[model samples]
Every structure is written in C-alpha cells, then in structure tokens.
Target: MLLNLYGIYGNFPLGKNDMIDNATQFGAAVASARKALGLTQRELALAINSGERFIVDLEAGKPTAQLGKALAAAKVVGLRLTATGTPQA
Candidate 1:
C-alpha cells in the first residue's frame, strides 16, 4: 500500500535542532511505514538482525553513526533512499 503522508506535519518540535529533527523525522517515517504494514518493532528489528532500540532510534529519527546500519535498517523496514534533483511529483 502506498501511503502519502507528511512525517513532519507540524513545527519541528520545540527545539531548533534540524540535524536531530532530521533524524527524528527519518525514524518517524520508518515507524509509520512499519505501522502501515502492521509490523511490530521487534519483528522488524529481528528481520534485520538488529536490536529493538536500534529500530526505536531509527524510528525516532536518530542520524545513524554508520550509514551501513542505517541503510540496512531502512531496507529491513521496506524503506528506500532515492536522490533526485528534480521536484517530486
């Protein structure tokens, strides 16, 4: 199912930390996608051979220290990263 929703609907929290906010937003996105697919955090974490906290952090939008882990988690949660200079449709 294709779900179109803004992960960041309101103001970016109270703090003005864009980097942290970015990570949090990213995590929220993963969390949302997982919920949309009806997958528990543990289930998703196990599927990706990771810890629940890791998923929690990711869903919380924590900028991963390592890109590989982030990518792996994203893949496990059916998330993909695409780069496009053009405006999205």
Candidate 2:
C-alpha cells in the first residue's frame, strides 16, 4: 500500500488514462517495490513461480515482457495497477 507522490510509482498521478507511459518507469517502480520488500529478483521469481530471466527483464523494463508474468510479479511485490476511465478535460 505504498503511495509515492514524488514518482517512485505507487499511486502517483499519471497522464490522461492513468496508465504508465513507458516501460522504464514501470520497471523502476517494480524494482523499487521489490527492494522495499527486501526480496531479491531471484527470490521474487521463485516466489511467483517465474524464471530469473523474467525478473531480470522485468527489472530492466523489457517492453515486451509478458503481461501475465509482470502482473504476477507486481502482485507478489505488493504493487497494484488499476484502470480508470479517461480523465475529463
């Protein structure tokens, strides 16, 4: 339930759709959350039943990484993504 207002990613205000604009931002957030939880990439991968390479790519912000696995990793690390309707102008 960490909400970083200054951009470490959790619950920060985003663009119109509230979606992260790029993989680098997403990856940094994931890495930050993982570290905050004191879990190593390999440990998180094992906990989430994913491969170490997947974790590496995820932390590196690989744009084409599988959404399912990425979401799963985020969950294990306590990161939550939500969707909202387009913001009003």
Candidate 3:
C-alpha cells in the first residue's frame, strides 16, 4: 500500500468517511481504477492523450492545478465522473 501522507491512501475501498476528504478521493479512485485494469501510468496517460507527468499529478490529487485535464484523463481511464452532492435540478 502506498501512503501519500498521514491520512492519504493510494488505493481502493477508500477509507474512514472517505470521499468527504476532497478530490484526493477522486484522484485516488482514478488511479485505483487504472491499476485494477492492469495498466501503467504511461499507458493511462497515452489513453487519455495526456502526458505521464499530468497523470501522475492527477493521481497525486494535485488537480487544483489542472482540473479539466484531470477529468478528461479520468474519463479516458473509464471512470465516470459525478457530483457528490445534490445537483441543482
């Protein structure tokens, strides 16, 4: 298990009130999804038409720097994006 920080985990089943933390959950989710599918960061990045560095950033939950690209990459990795809270109807 790769632990990024004191509270951050690098893989699935999230943890302790998980998604409540932040987009880190989303990023970690994407990374976990990709790994489960048996793909490397370089492969995922290529599939997303992005650079490995960007994918690394996204997986690291540093998305505040590039959200659109991160989401695009996430989509390429076959992960669906949805609003956590209630969407305005």
Candidate 4:
C-alpha cells in the first residue's frame, strides 16, 4: 500500500517498498527530501560539510559513498534511517 507523507514539501507518496533497501533508494529519498526543502544539492552538501561532488555521487546513488558522510547528509536532509522487525535467521 502507498502512504502519503505531508510535510513542508506538501504531499509525497511513501510506499512500503519505498524503504531504502539500497544506494539507489537512499539517493532518491535524499533527493526528494532535499527538493521538498527547496535546497540545491550543493546547498545540502555544504550544510552537511561535504563536497559538491560527493552530493552528486550521493544523489546518483553511488554505493561507495563514505558511511559517515552519507549519514551526515541524511541527517541534514531530514532523512532518518530506521530498521523494523527482527533479523532473519
């Protein structure tokens, strides 16, 4: 099912499968949140103390991005990472 998230960016879809399962999803979510906040990629990078190229790579969903930097960027963009349910055996 699809959920609608209403925030400063208005309303956006939030589906169950929309979870950030990989770099591509992470990038898309970051980009969506950033745009919703009316921020440019460079602006977000600066806010997170990262480089513009890093932001570009991040938005492009590059899996090799530094974990620290990626987490920082997510925080700046108001993206929170959370895990639900128990681990599979």
- List, in order, the clash count of every candidate structure: 6, 0, 0, 0
lDDT of each: 0.59, 0.71, 0.63, 0.72
The candidate that achieves the highest TM-score relative to the unseen native structure: 4
C-alpha root-mean-square deviation, each candidate: 8.9, 6.5, 7.8, 4.4
Cα-based TM-score, every candidate: 0.62, 0.72, 0.65, 0.76
lDDT of 1 by residue, 1-89 (tens): 12222322222221222222256656776676677667898988888787888887777666753567666765655565544344557
Q: Tell me the TM-score of model 2.
A: 0.72
Sorting all predicted structures by TM-score, with the top scorer first, yields 4, 2, 3, 1
| Alpha-carbon lDDT of model 3 | 0.63
Off by over 4 Å in 1: 1-21, 86-89
Please report how far candidate 1 places residue 34 from its true position, in Å.
0.5
33-64 in candidate 4: lDDT tens per residue?
88877899999989988789998998899999
| Inter-residue clash pairs, candidate 4 | none
Task: Please give the range of 10 consecutive residues that has the lowest summed lDDT in model 1.
Answer: 11-20
Candidate achieving higher TM-score, 1 or 4:
4
Off by over 4 Å in 3: 1-21, 84-89
